[model samples]
Structures are given as structure tokens and as C-alpha cells.
Target: MPELPEVETTRRGIAPHVDAARVTELIVREHRLRWPIPPELAEHVTDQPLLALERRAKYLLFRFPAGTLIVHLGMSGTLRALTEAFPPEKHDHVDIVFDNGRRLRFRDPRRFGAVLWQNGNPLTHPLLAALGPEPLSDDFSADHLAAQLARRQSAVKQVIMDNHIVVGVGNIYASESLFRARVDPRRAAASLSRIEIENLTKSVKETLADAIAQGGSTLRDFVDSDGREGYFLLQCYAYGREGEPCRVCGTTIQQIRQGQRATYFCPSCQH
Candidate 1:
């Protein structure tokens, strides 16, 4: 699945082509996604000018005069900006063609992504209303994290990964951040000291900024809207390095499963 960095990269890539451009058409090739593509999506967004583009967590928000177009790049979904007509591949699900002939194409092999239309405040949308603060925003601070994790018995990794605590700290980033912070993935969130919490918070920000700078890690099918693979995978320290030498310490790295997701760490480096 595309995480925060990948999604943010996509938003930046497609913004110039679509922002302030009128939506001449909205095409839905597959309406049966994680949520049905709103039946009236095409009708609703047809002639509206896209005022701006923004991303919340993993969802893409295309602002318009009427409402916002909410897009979730689910498990195998990707979005691209196309300048010319290319043959749609097998899973090419939707296209928002601009009046200028640019199209924002969405492809999802698993059909788990969604393209929904909403009127009024998008932040209040059901899918977005309950989401936690954006990880890259000022609202997500060490003080905020410490307050949330004060008495939680969940693992520190798990707590950070929880959308309720803070959005966009996915599996890969979580493991990398925890390793950088020298915090064991299995450590209780409540057991963390103020210094540890501050370190963890800084690690999270730096890890994500690096990933975004590298255009995000290409796990499986992730690519920027420009259709380029992210280079961050080559910079990983502990993720996917089971039995490999740790970058910080000479000890071999290890991998374990926490909440069904692979967790990697350096036993000697992470306490």
C-alpha cells in the first residue's frame, strides 16, 4: 500500500496539472472498490474547477467549488498524470480528465481503493473524521505523543502505527523509526521516558522526511505520480534486514511479527 510519503509525492506530482483546472470528465471503470465509487461522482464533479489539492493521511483530497474528491490508494492502487491517450491496462479503474487534456489516472489491481465525492467539509467526512493528526503537522509533537502514550500498554511500535495516535506511521516507517530511536519494538508505550518519547518523535519526523525526499520506499508497486520508483529502500537501516549486519552495531538484524506485520530491528542497537 502507498504510505504517507508516496501519497504526498503523488499529490505534489499531479497538483500542477490538475489544480485550478476544470474537470471536463470523470470516468469510472471500476466502481466496486473498498467503498463504491459514488454513483453521482461523475455528475457531481463534471464541470467544477479543482481549486487545490491536498492529502490527509493516505487519502488525496481534490478541492473544488462544489465539494472535494476523496481518493484512497488502497493496497495496490496508483495514480498517474498522463499527457496523452495510452491504452488502459487491465486494472486502470478511473480517470479524471482535465479540460487541458491532462488526465489523472487511477489504477488498482486489487480494486480496494476508493474514489468518492463529497460536499461540504471533507475533514468531517466519515472516513476522515476520526483520523489522528497528520504526522508531518505541528499538531503531532512529542508532547502530544507522550500524552497519548502515557498509560497505553501497547507496544511503542504498535502505538505509533495506530491511526488513532498519529496518522501515516505505517509498518516500514515504524520499524525504521523505532530502530533509529533505539527503542525495542516490543517495549510498552507507557514505559517510555520523556527523553525516549522525544527521541522517538524526532526519529519519526526525520524518517518520514527522508522517505518523502527519496520519493518514498517502493515496497511492491509504489511509484511517484511521475511513474518512478522511490529510492528510499536502498537507505533502509533495519527494515527487511533479518540476519543481516546492523548498520549501527555489528550484530545481525532480526525480524519479528507484531500485529501481523513484519517488524525489523537491531537487537544490539535497539534496547
Candidate 2:
């Protein structure tokens, strides 16, 4: 699945072409996604100019006058901005044809993605209403993280991965952030000191910011709107380097299962 950075990268890639463009038509090749594509999606959005493009957590928001179009690139979904002449592929499930002869295409082979419509404030919609603060925003600082962690006895890794605590810190990021903070993933969330929280918060922000700058980490089936793969995976410190020497201490990186997800760290470095 595409994490925050990857999602943000897609938003940035397609925003220029789609923003302010008028939707000429809506094409739904398959409505049966994670949630069925709205049946009257075309009626509501057609001929309407897209006001803006924003990302909330993992969902993409296409803002218009009437409402917003919310998109989630589930496990293996990709959205591309293509010229009108671009041919649709096998899994291309939907298209928002623009009056400018450009189209935004959505493809999801596994069919777990979503294309939904909202007639009211999209931020108040159930899917997004309770989502925590964006990890890259000022709202997700050390103070916020500490307050949340203080109430949870779960493993620090699991706590950080919880969307309710801080949205978009996915499995890979959680491991990498903990490694950077030199905090063991298995430590209880409430056991972290103020200094540890500060370090972890800074690490999370830096890791995610760096990944976004590098265009996100592409493990598989993830690409920007331009069909380009991300290069951040090349700089990973511990996420997938199990049994490899740590970059900082030359300690062999270890891997463990936390909440059924693989976590990597340097036992000699992370306490």
C-alpha cells in the first residue's frame, strides 16, 4: 500500500494538471472497488471545475464547488493524469475526463481502492472524520505524541502505527522512525520519556519528509502519477535490512514480527 509520502507525491504530481480543470465526463469501468464508486458521481461532478487537490491521511481529495471526490489507493492502486489519447489498461477502473483533453485515470488490480463522492464537507465524512493529525504537520508534534502514548500500553511501534494516534506512519515508517530514534520497537509506549518522545517525533517527521523529497519508498506496485517509481527505499536504514550491518554502528540489523508486521532494527543501537 502507498504510505503518506507516496500518496502526497501522487497528489503533487497530478495537482497541476487536474486542479481548476473542468470535468467533462466520468467513466467507471468497474464500480466494485473497496467501496462501490458512487452511481451519480458523474451527475454531481461533471462540468464542475475542480477547485483544489488535497490529501488527508491516505485519501486524495478533489475539491469542487458542490462537494469533494475522495480517493483511496488501497493496496495496489495508482492514479495517473494522462492525455485524452492515452489508452486505458486492463485494470484502469475509472476516468475523470477533463474538458482540456486530459484525464485522471485510476487503476487498482487488487480492487481494494475507493472512489467515493461527498455532497457535504468531506473532512466531516465518516471515513475521514476521526483520522488523527497529519504526521508532517505542526499538529503532530512531540507533545501530541507523548499525550497519546501516555495512554497506551501497547508497543511503541504499534502505537505509532495507529492511525488514531498519528495518521500515515505506516509499517515501514514506524520501523524506520523507531530505528532512527534509537528506541526499541518493543518498548511500551507509556514507558518512553519526554526526551525519547521528542527524538521519536523528530525522527518521524524527518524520515517522512526525506521520503517525500525522494518521491517515497516503492517496495512494489507504487508509483507517482507519472508512473515513476520512488527511490527512497535505497536509503532505508533498517526496515528491510534484516541481518545486515547497521549503517550507524555496524551492528547486524535484526528483524522481528510486531502486530504481524516485520520490524527491523539494530539491537546494539536501539534500546
Candidate 3:
């Protein structure tokens, strides 16, 4: 699954080419996506200029005067900016061609991705209305999360992973952030002290920012808009290093199943 960093990377990569460009045509090779690409999508955005391209959580918003085009990459999707002569691959589902002969291509093999139209304020849309503060936003502070978790009995990892508490803390990032903060994944959310919560917050921010800079980790099908795999996987500490020697301590890292997800931690280093 492409997380926040990967989506942000895609936004940055295609923004320069697509933003402010006038849409000449929209080609839907396959409309049967996760949500069945909005039927009137092609007709709606035909001659409109792309006002802006921004990312909210895991979805990308292509803003125009009338409305916004919302895109979610689901589990395995890639967006690429290409020239007219660029060859389309097997799974290329849609394309937004500009007047300049450039196109933004969307490829998703699993078809779990979506392309929807919004005629009103995108933030107020039901899909995005209740989402929590962006993890990178100034509003997502330690105090903010601490207050949200004060009475929650859920595991600290699960609490942070909750979209209502803070958006974009996916499974990969949750494990990495907890490992960096030296917090056990199974620790109760309400049991955290102020200091521990502060450390966890900082670790989450740093981990996400670093991953974004690195173009996101390519553990599976994730890739940058340019089709290059991310290099951050080479620097993972404990996420998938089960039974391996801990990077900080000499103890062997252990793996456990929590909520049916594999969690990795150092027995001696992470309390």
C-alpha cells in the first residue's frame, strides 16, 4: 500500500507538469476501479485547467474551479507524467492528457484505487470530512494525541494508527515510529506518560518526514512517479528484522502478531 510519503512524492513529481495545464482530453481505458471511476468524469474535466494538485492523507486532489478530482491509490497504484509517445503498460487504467501533449497516467493492477468527482468543498466531502489532522501539520502535537488517548484502552500502536486520532500513520510507519520511540507496540495507550508520548510524537514526525524525503519505502508495489523504487527499506531498524540482532542493543529483534499484523521490536531496547 502506498502511504502518505509515497502519495506526497507522487504529488510532487507530477505537479510541475500537470498543474496549470489545460485538460485536452481524459481517456478511461478501464472504468472498473475500486469505486467505478465516476461515469461523467471525462466529460466534466475536459476543457478545465488543473488549478492545483494537493494531497490529503492518502488521496490526491486535482483542484479546478468547478470542483476537485479526488484520487486514492489503494493498494497498488502508480501515477506518472508522460509525453504522448510514452507507451502504456498492461494495467494503465486512465490518462488525463493536456494540451501540451503531456499526460498523467494512472496504473492500478488490483483496481482498488478510485477517481471521483467532487462538486463542492473537498474537505467537507464525506470521505474526508472526519479525517484527523495531517500528521505533518502543526496541529498534530504531542498534547493533541495525548488528549485523544487519555481514556483509550486500545494498544498504543493501534490508537496512533487510528485515522481519527492522526491520519497517515499506516502499519509500516506505526511499527517504525514505535521502534524509534522505544515504545512497545502492545503498550496500553492510556498508560503512556507525558515524556513517552512526546517522544512518540517526535519519532512519528521524523520517521514520516524522512520517508517522504526518501521517496517512501518500496516494500511491495510502491514506486515514485518516475518508476524508481524507494531506498528507505535499506535503513529499517526492526520492522522486518525479526530474529536479527538489534541495531542499538545486542538483543535479537522479535516479531509478534498483534491484531493479525506482524509487529517487530527489540526485546531489550524497546520496553
132-226 per-residue lDDT for model 3 (tens digits): 99999898999998999899988998899888889998888898999999998888999999999999999999999988988899878899888
Single out the weakest 10-residue window by summed lDDT for candidate 2: 81-90
List per-prediction Cα lDDT, in the order shown.
Answer: 0.92, 0.93, 0.90
Give the clashing pairs for model 2. none
Superposed model 2: Cα runs more than 4 Å off = none
Off by over 4 Å in 3: none
Candidate 3 overall lDDT versus native = 0.90
lDDT value for model 2: 0.93
Candidate 3 minimal-lDDT segment of 10 residues: 81-90
lDDT of 1 by residue, 172-205 (tens): 9999999889999999999999999999999999
- lDDT score, candidate 3, position 93: 92
Q: Look at candidate 2 and tell me the lDDT of residue 263.
A: 90
Flag the better candidate by TM-score, 1 or 3.
Answer: 1
